[model samples]
Target chain A: MSDSPSARASRTTGTVRIVGAGLLGASIGHALRRQDVDVVLADVSPSQLRLAIDYGAGRDARDDDRPGLVVVAVPPDVTADVVQAELEAHPEAVVTDVASVKLEPFTELRRRGVDLTRYIGSHPLAGRERGGAISARADLFIGRPWVVCRDEETRAADLAVVEALALDLGAMPLEMTPQEHDRSVALTSHVPQVVASLLAARLASAEPGSLSLAGQGVRDTTRIAASAPELWVQILSANAGPVVEVLDALASDLREVSDALREPDAPGARRTIADAIRQGNEGVSLLPGKHGQNRRFEQLIVMVDDTPGQLGRLFGELGELGVNVEDLRLEHSPGAQFGLADISVAPDALRGAVEGLEARGWRIAGNTND
Target chain B: MSDSPSARASRTTGTVRIVGAGLLGASIGHALRRQDVDVVLADVSPSQLRLAIDYGAGRDARDDDRPGLVVVAVPPDVTADVVQAELEAHPEAVVTDVASVKLEPFTELRRRGVDLTRYIGSHPLAGRERGGAISARADLFIGRPWVVCRDEETRAADLAVVEALALDLGAMPLEMTPQEHDRSVALTSHVPQVVASLLAARLASAEPGSLSLAGQGVRDTTRIAASAPELWVQILSANAGPVVEVLDALASDLREVSDALREPDAPGARRTIADAIRQGNEGVSLLPGKHGQNRRFEQLIVMVDDTPGQLGRLFGELGELGVNVEDLRLEHSPGAQFGLADISVAPDALRGAVEGLEARGWRIAGNTND
Candidate 1:
């Protein structure tokens, strides 16, 4: 439960007060309570405050001892306002935020001349389709990555405390600049949602019969389209520059492919198609590979049954054979005999996993190694 | 078990004899058997045949009357030879091949002057990650769609038989010209796969530590990357023209996006970014909407608890309110007070679902019809 690098080496009696009592704040409180850490949840919205308390986010806020830390969980637009308020109330407490974008808040904090030593910026890459305090869960951060953005001016003690917070919440702590974090998220999350939403909106106007022919492929591409426009509008506007930049790059690649298709008979079509595919391959590497770590990876294929027990049996076998199951994908092929299971593992495990499956009475065919 | 539109109309028992006891063939057998229709499963590989039989795909080849429908479900390259073999042995049978792509076989069958009245082209929109008879299930085709393609010269009875076959399997039957079917699929499924694969392949080579920050968005985009390249190569090569066209269009869009990003402050940058998102929306609409139907939707926010019976309670409220939920998204904000639930229902039912929740001691917020 403690992957965060900043967690204290020794146990102690101290409170980590989470200000805002929203999604991130409440979820952190929930996770902390599970760890037996003293926590207090504060929110200006009386309704929101009551919800947090009733939902067991934390006990009511108290003004006694200076807190070990104060985590500001709020929207990017109002984050600095809440953070400044928290600082005024608890100056000795270290602070951090779990906002989607960070650059603006950092600047706003600096302008206020608040001691910057005790605060860091954290964005845990764990969330669902919903938002707000009611959506908070103690286990939401488990086994997920948490990025900590630190500047040269960030105090080491505060940074360590923030890392400890992430660890206590059961998230892996990662270090990056605010810019890098924003750009990566734009490429991976924000942009995709925008794309999905736009697509979904279009379908709402499409002819019913035409869309009736839709299958799983379309479903996959549009899964995130159901996101809230209000939330996305805030997110996109906050990270507009980087997010727009990534989309521009993607658009250019799309244009080149379009041109290549226009001249199908030209000898260049193959190269263009090949290049497009290759480009996608390259871009995808920036994502966390199958290990849920952002490692660059080649794909490996394994066939698995669609039945409930089959997945369990397959996972159990891979474990027994010492074949690291880095990541697995199940294609939603409609009415075929068996579901094609593609597993992405280290290059080293490819051969063994394939051979192991074959020996275990599984039909292992095609190139098992990428 | 009683969905055959033509079963009572025609007393003929044997139809669609599937050759090759593999995944595709087994699924075909399963779908056909559900209609109380007998499908003979055959394979040159005796062991494979036994496996298919074990999975209840068919009876021993020694049994039954001459089949009216003959299907070749072997690997793509062998599809032609097997189709020709079945046609030769069962001259009275209407024949088809369930290959991923059909241009080659369609031409081959034409050259052979096989009974035009007894042959057509069909592809079912379904399959799993795994393969072979052991993984077969009777309900594989339920509610999925099957595409049956025909040309001007196609026999009337052949089209009817295949359409009936689809109905018998409880699948929606869609009619298309062979060329149209190929191009549509190229846009919807094949190209998407190549793109996903390309991206996933790229992720394979990314920096190890950075990949840890990869999240669900990347996973969703690259899910199809784990496909078997050999199988994919065959599919792409067969539909190169249409696939190249779509990929090129995508590439064109990508190019525009990249060019805009190069000059971030340019007016063109904003326009390009918006266009890319808009196009994505347009493309997404080409997909089926929620619940396998296209319906205009708005979301209703509900505060749901994380307790054991809480989800049930929320669902029960929705059910009691008589709201047919169109879609639902769940999120757990880390530090927030409560989990957020976004339920998509028809515009008319937004008030009802919300009212139902509120009446059950649940709190509702945000925009709802009520």
Candidate 2:
């Protein structure tokens, strides 16, 4: 009830127009329409516009309506053209885009000689495996990072309006330049997607019995491989340089490991393989924990039956015990009748949490601080 | 409670002598000792043996005792030596080792001109990120696959004894040859580990701002990268041929993607990238669903606050409605105030499940079949 669109809409005021009735576009309209602000929707595809309108996203853009802000939410390939069109049509409006790639569109717009003062590029790192207006949600951006790209040419008032939009949608607004945003996403998002897809592709012609022994590690590493291929092609092609840089570095590391593995018994060969893995250990350890905190917590494993209310009962008992669960992970084997719940709690609360859960008849299988 | 070792031990009868008191060895001793079976623990390191005994994994091994089964649970580097010694010392016992690799030891024993009829090679695909008897769990192998490798010379009665041990430890026993086991694990385990570690290694030198946008996808892809480098070096080296084959194929694919991205505007560039990603989709789709069933379920997404009892209330309501949750996944942003709980249910139960939760004031954001 707290995340209801109507409740969130009261915090913002403006006439916002969305120019693409796809997932991001329709979702932005849906989130903004519930607020007191005026919203206009437009799309090249009449059917998509109709669908978004039927879903209560927004009304069709009328020629007489003067929007204060225009959000271009189209595929990366067509993002630059749409942003140019939106800016030309709404000369006074501050324009922003929700494209995943930022620098390419910015460069294209600048190449087209568009006014730079009112344009901002932003990306909200929130999406599902599916796409289209049918899958759009008003709360999709809630609590996710919405990076806003700006430079010295950006006006403070224009930047303020864009930040307000991100805030009204309950997304955290982070500021970065176009180059920085593109490079950052290349490291964190683009490279991982390509690596996952490549790893999964190797299994395409694998022996029939090879996958039967698949465990959680391989499953997690390749989970994102199920994402749409066509969408990724566009994203990867748009930011090819940065993505290729990261992939090349990883490929070099792979070559070293492969060579060392080929001659494992040779002198210093084991050391080569160990060095790469140790680098991985150091890199993964740098990731922030929940709430962007760097501190580690003790994990307590509890076994739960495959019943609907079993997890509910466990959490209820923990809540009654006044233990604050920092994070939680669930692991289950295929065909298993039960699952393991790894609950992370503050170090000081680990003993109390284990005792309380055990007293409530929950079996504590193990606990670890690493 | 059902997974308790005492309840499981009644199904088997034998004395188990474990030859190493590390994580796997100590855990086996702990599990076997809880049952009616007598467990004798030994290790090359006196302090480790003493610690395992103090932790109640098992009693110290006595020379006068005659064990029916001998488990060689040493590191991969010493697996062959330990297995040979165990087989030589206990001539009447059926011997097995819990090393991750299979072919090297089998080849080693064969090269030594030893009679291999009594030695069985097995690997239990269960482990924690950390190692040591202190981090051992009696239920570590519960519902996980424990692969047993045997040759034509192996007796049926001897194989039965090994299978019984796997079952008595609450693990599912799978049968494979030494070659098949090594090849399968190379594809599913070793290759993924290298891929994850290499991907994480790229992040080691990334810009400070790049990691702030790291999402669940990258986090999961690299989670296992934190494993000890020395342990992985031993595993990768032991299965070098098969692992190198997989990595070489993956490297070729990486090169193709990189070349295509470098000249995205070239002829058929987009097609090349799309083809690789499509192959990934096909490969990942072949994975078995939960419970080893190929059927798909409808997923319902519910937003829950970050409070302790919020999940409990949602699950409690589902329980009251008698709706069974087939699978569950939780996603939360780093600093988000709420998390999304995606609960999967049987397709036929979708309507009823949604209605039940909605009636209890739960908001249904969206649902999907994919």
Candidate 3:
């Protein structure tokens, strides 16, 4: 169901060199290599480079390799330095870096007096909670937003190369200024991380018994808090300005909520609390549904035995019923022998889907549409 | 693998009366009726009572009926009032109320000088984001912690009845004082709800493009913010003290984080930021895994096509390989034709599980143990 490597390789000719053989770097190499593109992997850490190569990410980079494009995928702190080095080493190459924060490195490079025309900054809003080449996948960027930060000085050809890189990896390329990219991520990513961490941190001193009552709600809220601190420190610090702005606004909101709750019977206190929560409902509603579409699908909950192949038979039956599943979520009671499969389908198809599954001896626990 | 209803009914033989047939009330009726126990459901709303009865929750309650157990399943505000009325109406029956906020209702009843010996307060730590009788399930309490708050004046026989109800519904019964139950839920449930709402509320006034970059991190952090504001307003207000305390601590933490980010190069700023995030990791690590076990399992990622029966085939092969899955999570790339199934197994079984699955033509993406 994916485009063939030969077909992709025919569109862009010449070697693509990737610096920093970490998760993003190796993942890009893997995706490009699958398309039969010549990808040269380079890194300061010899072991990481070798591991990435062994995992079929790319071939080892050599001194004489004159690549058409150079992807700088390194730590945020060193990204500017590496981008500068990559450009200086391969003057003819269109250089792009897949860093989380765009403005910081762009500013740093500009301050260092690096030639700006050949450099195009891009960020693929894609990654697993874990990091490193070992956890990297060739399809990591598939269908995710890959933001390209272009300036007036950026050459059209150079910008085209980065956009094509996103396209070749099956990611949607979005154009934004560096400032817009940083500010946007601060709200969507950085602030959420801080909020989650702060919420989870409260449990540090909580009683053991209290933690036992933790349900999926708190678990989901704090799931990303398990992320490595050192990596987050770097990401957070690099985008500190934008992130701090977001945090300040959130802090003010928190203060108002705390004040309202402290004096619950006061005038407008209930309104304040309810409005804050209602705002949250409005905020979350803006999020696009599956495949980045705004259309809402009805959810049907079907109980499946925890045994093997139960879900398989259920999905097979759904297929036979001609139901196209938009999304699927599986949840299990901690000690129960069965789990609930929340399958989302078109609203019109919900009745037929439920009837068909029920006919197949699958118990429909409940549905959202009802 | 579940015990038949007849077996459960034989152990506790008596009519169980449920008051206020909402989610918890109706769910209790559904579960008890399945065990062939006589269940009488009463509610203020005639239509809701009729709906519950039609859904096989229970039959209508009658004045002539004598109940062995009277379960008060009303809203928090009316819980104490209903409990008092139920006790007055059924003087011989043991009365237990399934209120999320245990302390408020318990105190309210006690303040009115109600008979304390017959009243036991309990909370089942189970619910969907949605509410009402339509969303109720027989297995809602299955494998969940049902906190039974026993006071010093409570009779052993009355306590036993509440515990028995939890057991009959396939829940794990936990004993805690009313104060302990309220504080515990404030940390595990209420605070998380507020934090999620606060985080999501930030997105309300955000730039349209900023929200488009939202990923799974923000999504999970704010998922529960979509919960009904009116319902949560009641829950939060009823237990305002403990919830306010949790929110205050979080507000202080947020302030510190904002300050730290404001001066990223300060002497202790980085340390403070990293420490807060690290504390989050510690807090989450304390959360018990499946079946209330703290032991960590190895996770193996397997790539499966987004088609019917693919997961079934995979699980069947795992079963054939004698692999017991401890937990499972599925993630899909938007617009991708495949999904990654992260299967957790016991550490000692990780090697065998991976090898077995790979041998059966499964593509193992990676494993935590690797």
lDDT per prediction? 0.64, 0.86, 0.84
Q: Pick the candidate with the highest TM-score.
A: 2
Top DockQ model = 2
Query: Chain A: TM-score in each candidate?
Result: 0.79, 0.95, 0.95
CAPRI band for model 3:
medium
* TM-scores, one per candidate: 0.66, 0.97, 0.95
Instruction: Tell me the spans in candidate 3 whose CA falls farther than 4 Å from its real position.
Output: A3-7, B3-7, B348-363
Q: After best superposition, candidate 3 residue A285: deviation in angstroms?
A: 1.5
iRMS of each prediction in angstroms?
8.4, 1.9, 2.2
Candidate 2 regions exceeding 4 Å error are: A1-12, B1-5, B8-11
Candidate 1 C-alpha lDDT tens digits along A1-370? 1233124342324888888887778888877876678888888898888898888888887657578788888877788888887777887887788998877687788898977776788898877556677877776675667899998988887788888877776666889888878876776677666545443444454433445556665577666655554556556667877767656655555555555555644787657666555555556545543334345434544455433235445655766677654434454334333444555556776787778777887654333331
lDDT of 1 by residue, B1-370 (tens): 1332323443335666888778778877865665567778888888888887876778766554588888777776677778777778888887877787767677767797765555677887766555667666554565567888787777787678777777666567788766766776675677667666544554454444545555566556565655555566556756777777666655555555545545645765656556555555555655655335445786776655433234445655566566654444444333232344566667877776666677777655343442
Q: Kindly list the per-residue Cα lDDT of model 2 for residues B1-370, writing each as its tens digit.
A: 5755567435556678999999999999888877757888999999989889899898887778788899999999999998999899999999999999999999998999988999999999899877888888788888888999988999998998889888888888999998889988998899999999888888888887778888888988898898899899999999999999999888888988999999999999999999988988887777666666567788899988888678778877787777777777777766776778888888998888788888888878788842
Clashing residue pairs in candidate 3 (N, C-alpha, C atoms within 3 angstroms): A5-A35
